[model samples]
Target: MDRTQYLQQFVDETGWYNSIVLGLILPEWIWRPLPFPLQSWLRNYIGGSLLYLVSGFLWCFYIYYLKRNAYIPKDSIPSYRAMKLQIIVAMKAMPWYSALPTLSEYMVESGWSKCFSTISEVGWPMYMVYLLTYLVLCEFGIYWMHRELHDIKPLYKHLHATHHIYNKQNTLSPFAGLAFHPLDGILQAIPHVICLFVIPTHFMTHVILLFCEAIWTANIHDCIHGKVWPVMGAGYHTIHHTTYRHNYGHYTIWMDWLFGTLRDPEDNYKKGE
Candidate 1:
């Protein structure tokens, strides 16, 4: 099977990873807070779905901040009309993020949640672990998912290539990158859902992380802060766009090195290839 098919099959048999998290062994702090009434409201027709959609779309900003002109056409780039086609594709696919609410829905359907309860009982150190793990799991997932987008040809051509249209990059490009090919966006959420099922993260941490990511990406999409990041520099990410083949890690660049996709632009990778 090809990559997508392979992942599909892997998920089919072992998909229980996500199922187990949301289905049987619920993370009390994370999953148990959703009382049936609130759960139904959030899942069926409330602010939860909107938050998911906004978060997906907001990632575009981060793409821009990493590499300011990454999406715009250089002297050698495409026309504005062409770029819109990519934008259209991304916007068109927005509705697909609705699938994410199902994790919360799972808890509601099972009557396993007890919404709004305080998480004051948990120890301080465990909370630290939760935050760290959540960050690690999230960043790792983004890196691999990004690398997969590059390694797989079919996905690259249909979904990824749309973003690569910019020979000259700029802000507003992250939105371009996120114009996923339907399957891509849904897969992004699956991991987080799984985390909720198995990992015991506090409701506040979960919400805070989600919100922080939103603000971070929104800034990333803005050109005003491309090279000068909010806290640290984005040189690692900037180089990735400059080289196109290296530095695929998001949030942090260390994971790309561990996975072996990190490349140094200074060394002509193909000088000897």
Candidate 2:
């Protein structure tokens, strides 16, 4: 069959992209008063900040307060001072983090990226392929960006070290997710934006995936094993915080395994016992 004919089977009028942007990204009443770029940036900053605060607070409370006794040892819970510092650092970096998306939106609107407004434009099969490709590229980019943040002394000492301060279980929490020097956080997140240029992605899917980083980071810092193979769970991330030389992959452990930096939680447990 011809390419057009094959793709025609997957076409469906799902106005998902417009709906998401109107309902979530640019709420009409709230952002209508502002001008082009300002409205975009403001919406991004407010949305990002709210996502970070709400997700971090609720997750931290669930694990640290509601399930403290059952979830973690009392002494292992992060100190209030540590969590407070994490929140302060994250809030300070959030505006800068929001700028990346603002810039990305501009790039997409300017036709610099291969971003499609809806899945039907690329067809379901091709869209799924593009989504998977975007994720793989992101994993690869983040893995190296994270690793180099440690390998390069100036980068680590000046930028990444802010995050490494919470290097112990007792010093780490969901609040520690976005707690990085602004540049450091942005550098790591650049992968998501970079993928847009390299692959054909659904615009709304890309935006949702970008924001999902906040939730994913929080999950990885919670110190729960999760035991889902190939996924870089909190157990793997906890090791990264302490060891500083392994498990630098984001979203998945495939990069770490490929690069010979993968350290399993079971191995750590065996050593401890």
Show where candidate 1 strays beyond 4 Å: 1-87, 102-117, 170-174, 211-214, 221-235, 238-242, 263-273
Model 2, which residues run further than 4 Å from truth?
A: 1-30
TM-score of each: 0.57, 0.89
- Model 2 per-residue lDDT tens digits across residues 160-241: 9999999888998998999999999999999999998899988778878989999999889988779998799999999999
Model 1, span 1-273: residue lDDT tens? 454553343224223323443444445465447653333233322233344346634553333334435743343233445445655765565455443544554452343432211355457786777668877787778777777787889977876665455434342343444445656655654555556555665654554454354344433332232433222123344445555677776566578778776654324335532
Cα distance off (Å), candidate 2, residue 98: 0.3
Give the number of the best model, judged by TM-score. Answer: 2
> Each candidate's lDDT (Cα)?
0.49, 0.85
Candidate 2: residue 72 lDDT (0-100): 76
Give RMSD (Å) of candidate 1 vs. truth: 11.9
